[model samples]
Target: MLYNLYNEKKDNRKEKFWFRAIFYLFLLIFIGTVCWIFFFSSLLKINSVEVIFQETQTEYDLFNKDYLISLVKTAFQTESSGFYLDHISRANFFLFNVDHFSQLIEKKSLWISKVEIYKKFPQSIQIIIIPRDGAFILQGEEDFLVDGQGMVFAKKNDFLKESATLPILSFEMKRSVKINDQVLESKSAKFLTIISSIFSEQSGFELKPEFFTPSLISNELEAQVVIDNGWKIFFNTERDPVIQSKLVRKVLDEVIKEKISDLEYIDLRLPGKVIYKLKGQPINADDSDAQESKSESKEKKDDRN
Candidate 1:
């Protein structure tokens, strides 16, 4: 009877062990089903995308909508590492990488300057595109439209109306530029623009805008504005362009005063003075008989005296 009781206890332990094993197996299957429903299922996949563009100054045709849509769609379908395998669909809303997509768009599209992305819950995406606009025209071996940030975006032939109206800046030699390249420094471009507007308004003649930025040397870092009357004016780029402009206006009104034909060059690079050279005399000539009207900076005056 004691032996029979021991056997009964052993059999009871075996039954409990089987029951625990079955319960654990069912729990694992239930957890796996939940993971499949949330991750590998079709309910959370992205099915649609909407693209909105910021209004740009250039023609709408410059930014192609179909190309942009294709790029976004391609980004959405990119493959990701799976939980069980190497390939999985990135179309799922939770798996989509927004930062990577934005960078991809900006990198590939030259017309696009900025991009914003939004994910609509349950199955859609929205993106906004901001395009680059022409700020000035740089004429060289080829002409290009440059934005305020100094990036070249399009060719001149592409925008005829804009090319006609905007200020034209040229180098002495041809500039090798392609789309999406920075052709000018922002500071230099702004200085040239200010000088152009001021000269056009005051002198009543458009400048042959050739900016010489060859070196750090003072002589090479000058703005040469050739007037219609066959004379020139030189401005120091390192100096304040506003003050130089004021001095130019003052000399035009008070000193030169319609004597532009006799003028060789008005050198405003000098501070507190306006130096004018005439056609007959050489530049930096001693003002003895007054063929060249002289305005000298303190250093120059000290040299002459």
Candidate 2:
């Protein structure tokens, strides 16, 4: 009777273990099904869409309403195959889609700030944009606006009929006009250094050049620096621009003291020599021949008299 009781007790324990296992299995399935119905299914089925932009410009409106919505819908369909409840993954996917959409739009001036996804019901997404702060023109032909990094983010339409009052960058025609990436990578560092040194010496004076064109005469790339005051300074690219600038300042101080403005060209290419041509004086080799001819004529007149 005792043996029979032991076997019965072992059997009861086995039954209890199986019962608990089945109960927990069913509970897990029920929870999973509830989650599938409430969150994933409902979230995946977008019902409404919202688009936001920092600025309400016509161009921004066109992109947010027309172009970006369609792109997001397509992206959502592709992403829904492997959707998750993790907030991090959702945020990352949204950012990725924003960047992709921005590239597809190809509007250089438009900057994307935030792309948000909301679960309304059937199928939709929300997108937001933040455009760059400053807008500048490029080469007087192309309209490119730059971000804080000096990157050319967007290019406006030529027919927009807008006048941009930014300083024109007059370097060689490069593949990109952005000053942030390409400039630092290329010859811009040296140029920037020169500009900085000039600024340090000339306190309280703004020396922004309207255009920078390459000079023909000197080994250094001479820039025809046009200031807002209608005075043009011929700056050399090779020499330390700081030293050259000091020399220029000295010459200008003297010239201003003498009250001279009828100057043709000021050559800052050479060291210790600030050669300037008067308004009517010839600056080339031909001037010597003219001077000799005039002297000869004057001698003949004296002999004849």
Candidate 3:
């Protein structure tokens, strides 16, 4: 009986030994897999990067390969160094957070409007870029490039200097504005920006005003625009610009069709009305002589009668 008990105990020891061995092997594999997934994995490394610009733009050099690679590397390094003790907080093919990368790109540039990152599993990354739409040039103490949102992105460059097609705005400010600052925050500037968008849509009737002037008249805001012709058209700041523009266009078109070149001023301050002035003709001495002759003839006819 004791021999049988010893044999049973030996069998139990063998079973325990095998169980421990298998458990230890699985533990080692788990640790190794975690390490491989977090680091030193060929499937998770960034092998190739592709840049795709959404539209044709020559303004900024944000799509250079070297520049984008460096930007990505910097973003990943920051993610890896964060204090969160968790599983694989990094930027890689499989583990890269697209939203985080987008946010990083946005923070890096003030002119970039949209950024999209696409990952082709285990190797390549595609980045799509969309820049802000440029509206017009604002000429003040210093010239600036303004966007549709009235945001001043950069200083005026010579590339678009021949943009006579775009309207020029002249504003006077007592304070200075920094780069990427929004200087066109006033109501008049906003109205002008909205009008520019409208002009862009209307291809049939192009309203490319040469200049915009905003001022205060009788403690009320007023805006004036010089159209293609030399005439100065006035607008009331309190009125809706859309309605005012429509009225001005209708009156101007009529005047233009009539071939009237004596236009001096156009006032669109009144609701649903347009007030205009024309250059008056001066009377000459010839007109007086003709009138005197006609009067003498009429007097002689009356005496005969």
TM-score for all models, in order of appearance: 0.55, 0.47, 0.62
- Model 1, 229-269: lDDT tens digits are 65666676545565566566666676667766787777765
**Local distance difference test, candidate 3:** 0.57
Span of 10 residues, lowest total lDDT, candidate 1: 285-294
Cα lDDT tens digits, model 3, 89-161, are 3545666677877887777765567888888877677878665555667777776666766687756652333
Please tell me which predicted candidate would have the highest lDDT against the true structure.
1
lDDT of 2 by residue, 146-193 (tens): 443445545544222344334444445444444233222123334432
Candidate 1: TM-score?
A: 0.55
* Weakest ten-residue segment in model 3 by summed lDDT: 282-291
> Which order, best to worst by lDDT?
1, 3, 2
Q: After best superposition, candidate 1 residue 230: deviation in angstroms?
A: 11
- Please, what is the whole-model Cα lDDT of each candidate in the order they appear? 0.64, 0.47, 0.57
Top candidate on TM-score is 3
Point out the higher-scoring one by TM-score: 1 or 3.
Answer: 3
lDDT-wise, the better of 1 and 2 is: 1
